[model samples]
Target: MVHVYGPHIFHTNDAEVWEYVNGFQRFMPYKNQVKTTSRGHVYSLPINLHTINQFFGKTFRPDEARAFLERQADKSITDPSTFEEQALSLVGRDLYEAFFKGYTEKQWGCSPTKLPASILKRLPVRFNYDDNYFFHKFQGMPENGYTDMVGQILDHPNIEVQLATKYRRSDRLDAIHIFYSGPIDGYFDYEDGRLGYRTLDFERFHFDGDYQGCAVMNYGDASAPYTRVTEHKHFSPWEEHQGSVCYREYSRACGPDDIPYYPIRLVEEKALLAHYVARAEREKGVTFVGRLGTYRYLDMDVTIREALDTARHYLPRAAARGHMPSFLEKAIAC
Candidate 1:
């Protein structure tokens, strides 16, 4: 079996998801100190008060900080629609160039101006000292690590996991219900052209001691090729390791052979996705779930919550021999 560590920090408002994750007894809580490297300087992420003060070299108070940002914001962008417009409206040109422009371009393989404004909506600009990356009430990772936790979850008697097995369209399994979590386009053999995605290439290296002093360090310079560097050792701070392993992550447009990470829901891709969704609805006895199945990028918490909800929806339908509607109804909008 190939084991992959779940590097994402579990942070969400969903109580059910929180309770489920905690039940694993591997909760390792830590405040996310995400940093960005740009032009030989390091700054806190999400445009917090400290970052704002440091950027302008002025230790402004909370109220002053708010006013300072308002002044920095581009009043000309009265009705911002694109990502670039949204950034200018929120933080003005300097901060956008220093932080968002290069990183966004690197991650998406497109100019920020071409992307949707909604992409920047989740990013918060706080006028407080709270440097936590996510504002969610619960924030942490599995103690023993995600691979072990997932192994334990799969140890249940009811679950049957077949590792390294390939399921093709030609293959048939005897089952009451099927929850497909693979790529939606792949299910229909990409009759409509394949949707766009951004895949990552991790260049791993080892260090004798702590490197970068954080779990994730984003490179925001347009000249820098890679998007971020992630230190694996920092992920599980509860454990001690003499050496550290880090990955300089590079992002590129995904090809047929590459593993898809982030979905690129641009105009053309969305049109393709719509065609696939219509085809999925016409099909029978298969319900799509998870990110790739629905053609939307989803965080770990939302994915798990949706999976649990999908199971709940499936049970009743399975008992009554009724149809299970695709759990991700809003996937197209994503």
Candidate 2:
């Protein structure tokens, strides 16, 4: 199954949320084992024992490997502030330059020093040989794909689907409450300023045969113009296909016309984001939810969990014709 945008693997530890989505569509077992092409060699991601041994050309045990990395790490960076420092402290200069430095610069359109350490916190450095990308309890892909599952969820008699309509603050709708999932800045017509975001451009092509032999193959070389190459067929391994559909992903600063993917929460953006959040808190008759509305990078399962929580919180108030709160749980930048 090909993703219209890019590959999204649904993995979460929330059992209730997992059971809830399974009601709509069947999910086949899938684990995302990402690969990175660094210095003309392919390596398993998360910087595990396999990668460590291969890179340094040594047979290291778990404890030995951990100690080796400890030695390699820059002990001087006692208080790591930036992502670069964090990586140097964790994997040392060699691994950081190999796997993180170049790819991060390409993806964010900024140096790793400019990014926060929290951005690199998502990546794990393991001692064991486990190649699984995530540590989540439950991981899988929708059998029929995400589109079909979303369609089933939206196939309600009361719900209406509007196409190609732009939202504005001035437009009034006949509804008791509103859940504004659009951009928090856009809702206010960018009155204060636009928050920074990284938008992805996908150059899609069809291959006569298997492409890259993996779902996601990242390029860690700074020389490479693009970030990664995704082969669609590798995503759904249950279904067999002779040909493959692939995409070369390029990440850049999001413009007014581009579709934003990642929220670039740099110092400048955080200052700008604070203004928008304060403005949203004061507004009434609407609630902000999802990644865009809150200006945070959230996984699908967490998004669904929050959506469910928001709905439960809103229903009683809607029934009694009470005033709706702007946000059930607010996002604050620290």
- TM-scores across all candidates? 0.95, 0.97
In terms of TM-score, the best-performing candidate is: 2
* Local distance difference test, each candidate: 0.84, 0.91
What lDDT tens digits, residue by residue, belong to model 2 across residues 1-334? 6787888999999998999999999989998999999999999998899999999999999999999999999999998899999999889999999999999999999999998888898999999999999999999999999999999999999899998999776564665667999888989988888999999999999999998988999999999999999998988999999999999999999999989887998999899988888888888788988889888999999999999998888889788987777877754555
lDDT of 1 at 133: 92
Q: CA lDDT of 7 in candidate 2?
A: 85
Candidate that scores best on lDDT: 2
lDDT per residue for candidate 1 within 1-334, as digits (tens), equals 1113224777998888988988875587877788999989999997899999999899999999999888989999988889999999999999999999999999999999999999999999999988899999888877776777778878899999998886665553566667888888988877778999888887888899999898889999989999888887787777888888888888899999999887989999888888888888876778888889988878989989988988888888788998777544564554
Clashing pairs in 2: none
